[model samples]
Target: MQRSPNLANSVSPTNIGHVVFGIGGSTSTWGNRKSYAESWWKPNATRGFVFFETIPRKHLPWSISSPPFRVSENTSKYKDYDKHPIPQAIRLARIISETFDLENKGVRWYVLGDDDTVFFINNLVDVLARYDHDEYLYIGMNSECHSSNSLHSFEMAFGGAGYAFSYPLAKALVTNLDVCLKRYQTLYGHDHILQSCVADMGVSITHEKGFHQIDLHNDISGYLSAHPQSPLVSLHHLDAVDPIFPSMDRKESLNHLMKSSKVDESRLLQHIICYHNPTNWTFSISWGYSLQIYESLIFPSILHKPLQTFTPWTKVIRPPYFIFNTRIPSNDPCQAPHLFYFDSHIENTTRGGDYILTTYTRGKIRGLPACNHSADDISKIVVFSPIRKHHLNGSRRECCDVLRIIGRDAAELKLRDCLENEILP
Candidate 1:
């Protein structure tokens, strides 16, 4: 592909870097979609040269029309959309490399990202300045989904969110893809395949924790409110309901929250509500109704019990709330899960007052007590120790001492027995 002379001269050849922001779907959607392009792209267009690519939604079920920007049509019959993104990315990278004469010209970097990404232009420039262009592959945010290996630890490079590659690295990736696609056609998902390919080729990837993607659906106001202080250069709003700046409905709410500096608090409370009684089908459909009942009614009741027990000692110390059975079930049992608990006194001490109570059994626990008094059947309980924590810094120690005084193995063990026998029955 020949470079347009006008485009070549319009951008400074010496300082010209390309930000290949890839947008998929038809032209109308791209125009109307609540995205970073609609909000921040035009405003910050002067900061660096901008180029756009639209992945043609031909083989995918989403759309059939040609989009506004240059479209890469996936001629292959593969129905799985996840598999095609990387090949499309590689193709775009090659186009940029050839057009810019990446080797000869002083095009220092190439940033690749999705349409949903909102750029913090000033912060990004600052971040880019710290790295020497020759050796590093800088990823904005690392993916929580992929695991890293010893040979080449997988720090997920954001293919959907934004990631920047140095000129040499971008060139090498483009060169490498020609061979990679030919050898591995079945590896479908973009980020995973890219991670695998890069690692296999002996490329070292370093994570810059400052890069983040907006993957969380439940908490929008809280996330964006933290962005100003956060080291992240780009925020990728991957999920639905992202305000994306200037959108009337959410933007007004966001602005009101930001003005009061209460966005985080509001978002936190909202999250608590959703966590307790989620309305979305995404959450309810996956896990069975029993799981929902545990989260909504049973666990909360158990967690609140410690408060009642310790409440009378208000002069010396406030009673703590025990959060139990907080872990989300996984396909595998070995993976550790997150749990939290808090005491009123301890809550007053920390920035975020809630502290973790003690963890439960590693294996599944059964015969847990029911919240309803009439229920005779004890539900089976599965407790994972690492998941739980006490609210006080030394509360676990205190609990252990109390357990020993009462002739028990450990505080956790004693508590487990008490809940199973006294509380349940």
Candidate 2:
């Protein structure tokens, strides 16, 4: 198997070499099932990448003779219809592993995906560059958590739309599947099982937010629009099309869409290259501990901090009280803080009262004094403080009174000094 030319500089034959695209189901989107595979999946399988489609025994088409891929079906091993899709897919993957003799091939990367996926190989290549071929078992995208007790929150596996695993890792995964499945039986979803299984193996899972799995009804247009510049391994349009021939004539529509859409290859490649930049920050944050107040507070304050810091290592001077500590969550998109600074210089200055305070919960900007000095218009002198829970019911009067007693002149001088020394050059 050959490797991606872009990765030829770094990826050796022994490194990440082969890409296995797992297409499950008998759904015919184009003319036939096999045609769907040839038109949609095969072209993306560049030099080093191999495409394999897994279909149920009943759905296997005869035209698929001497098919480059092998087909696996649900057997007596999976008597439980309750576990239909997941177990069936797993079994098929195992069969592929054995059929290809991948166990001994030292194949490091295998992308487990669906048939409906349309991928920009260039974007995928960018994602593959981040990890060496040795590191396998990667999930392309994750589903959003909507509930507090959702089991999905506990693990990091994305929609089973598509994922990649190293050959050794896949072997290890199959070896450990029975135990993992037994333990996490309470978790109903396949993705949840995947998460629990991989996490138990201690395999690091890389999540690509740009990888959209079109499971919902309205997702087709939304996903298609997003894909032009998306760094997606592949899109999984599960149940988006039926298995029967001429199913809604969607294949033609899809083909037409792909043809009509102006996919700027250069722009798409640029988008994928830049995709890793945003993710670098996300991966940097350790989610081991719960977020803290200070962490929350600093997140917003340092929204542009990374961009600034990475620019020239040029530190952004901030107020003395505005110290940044990773122990507390900063105003990160993932863990945004409740408090935010009100910059008058910026347009749409909603929060510009005597105290320059804004409601963190409501996102409303209103002007008010640090104290009840509404007439003073001392917005510049009084720095807005975060509404800590302890300050509710006006119980923390001492702190407020102390600042008020310091007087506007002293406060202005202090702020000016801090600004000059800390923020500005």
- Output the number of the lDDT-best candidate: 2
Residue lDDT tens for model 2, 166-242: 66666777677667556665565545565667778887667655465543332232122212223434544433433
lDDT of 1 by residue, 42-64 (tens): 33232232223454343234322
Q: TM-score of each candidate? A: 0.44, 0.47
Counting clashing residue pairs in each candidate, in order, gives 20, 15
State how far residue 19 of model 1 sits from its true place (Å).
5.6
The best candidate by TM-score is 2
Model 1 off-target regions past 4 Å?
Answer: 1-28, 42-68, 73-104, 144-154, 222-230, 238-248, 251-425
lDDT of 1 at 10: 57
Model 1: how far residue 146 lies from native, Å = 7.6
> Per-residue lDDT for 220 in model 1?
40
Question: Scored by CA lDDT, what does every candidate get?
Answer: 0.35, 0.37
State model 1's lDDT.
0.35
